[model samples]
Target: MNNYEQVLVALRRVIRATDLHSKRLSKTAGLTAPQLLIMQTIRDLGEVTIGTIADKVSLSQATVTIILDRLEQRELVYRVRSEKDKRKVHAHLTESGGSLLDRAPQALQEEFIRKYQNLQSWEQNMIISSLQRVAEMMDASGIDASPFLDVGPINRDHEWKNPTQRDDRKPDPASKLKAS
Candidate 1:
């Protein structure tokens, strides 16, 4: 294959890897990547504010709030209004949360970070530069993306429906390519 085709294929491989791994993790741990990330962050930073977790995880406060809502429903985490400031809420892990976290697998990005850091300085710079160039080429510069790369289904509790039959969701652009 030519250079362009090769690049596209490689990109597809990366995406597929992330998607499949995310699905596997969901099935095994019953937690989405973002959920696990927030749990880990809470454990690492004791009784952290929602804003602090948002900053550490590179997610918006609104998004973090939604995830926290779900986690709270599951009884894995608890929130408290700061004693000094009732307006400031902080998240803390429950015993269940700690147990779940102990059993959860390392995030794909975390594994990648460990391996990447082991690489020589030149190799690391080259990879980062190439990825940045690709992001610029795709017109995705300044996009607010977290290190979490799970692109699979977000809500596993929702019944699975055919992609073509989902009226609530937009059509996938690649479906046309597959049709042709």
Candidate 2:
């Protein structure tokens, strides 16, 4: 096959893998991929605003809102208006939500994390550096990107009243149609 076709095939495989994992996760956890993603984000950053959740999940606010709606309907989470800023609404997990999380297994894709952790330090750094380089090249190519260029802009409003939420830590390119 041609180079372009080879790349398409590889990407298709990646997408398929993610889809399979999502389905499996749903069956095992009773949570869709997005729902599980939101739940994990909320668990990690207790009482977070919709904007923060959207940024964490790399989704639009409206999309996150819909996910939140479904979660709320299931009584998995509840929202409360920020007292300091009434306009802002924060999502907090319910008792049932915490219980559900306790039962859910690590996401299937998390195998990558475990495997990566087992790698030698230099190997891990090399892999991360290589991926960062690739991401930079794609970004530089003006690849029909989103407004938030990187994760930095997404979390600028980091100072929440609780002050406890903190943790550290995509794209295409066209050849001249070739030659890399």
Candidate 3:
């Protein structure tokens, strides 16, 4: 295979890894990647507003609000109007939300982060620059993307996983591959 073909294969592997993890998370915890991330942010920041959650997750306020609406419907979280100000509202994870979060698998990025942090500073910088160049090549440099990874609709519910499928899991094989 050519050099370009190898690059495409590596890119596809990264994408497939993300999708597999997302499906596993959905099956195990009944939450999409975005939903889990928003909930985690809310829990970390406690009683925050929609804008705060959005900013913390690098998503738009409108996007956060929509996810909040879905979470509220699932009774995973609730919002309260601030007594001191009628114009203000704060989001809080419900008891169910906290419990589910405790049991939910860590986000795919968490594993990548753990591995990434162990790399030498120069190696880390090289990876960043290479990925940035790839994004630019794909005309995706200007796209507004949050940090989390999930393939389906951002507002999709926990019931999105397939019941018939089973995972015969293994360590991420891609992690062992090095760019030449």
> Candidates' lDDT values, in order?
0.83, 0.70, 0.87
List where candidate 3 sits over 4 angstroms from the true fold. 158-180
lDDT for residue 132 in candidate 1, whole number 0-100: 95
lDDT of 2 by residue, 1-180 (tens): 998688668757765776666556566666765676688889999989999998987888887888788788678899999999999999999999888888876665467778889999999999878656656765754443332212222212212122353333212244344656
Positional deviation of residue 8's Cα in model 1 after best superposition, in angstroms = 1.6
Best by lDDT: 3
Can you write out model 3's per-residue Cα lDDT over 1-180, one digit (the tens) per residue? 999999999999999999999889988988889999999998999989887888888888888888888788778999999999888789999999999999999998988989999999999999999999999999999987787777876766667434455444645456568532
For candidate 3, the TM-score is: 0.83
Position 122, candidate 2: lDDT: 100
Colliding residue pairs in candidate 1? none
Give per-model CA RMSD: 9.7, 16.5, 13.5
Model 1 — TM-score against the truth?
Answer: 0.81
- Candidate 2 residue runs with Cα over 4 Å from true position: 1-13, 114-180
Clashes of each: 0, 0, 0
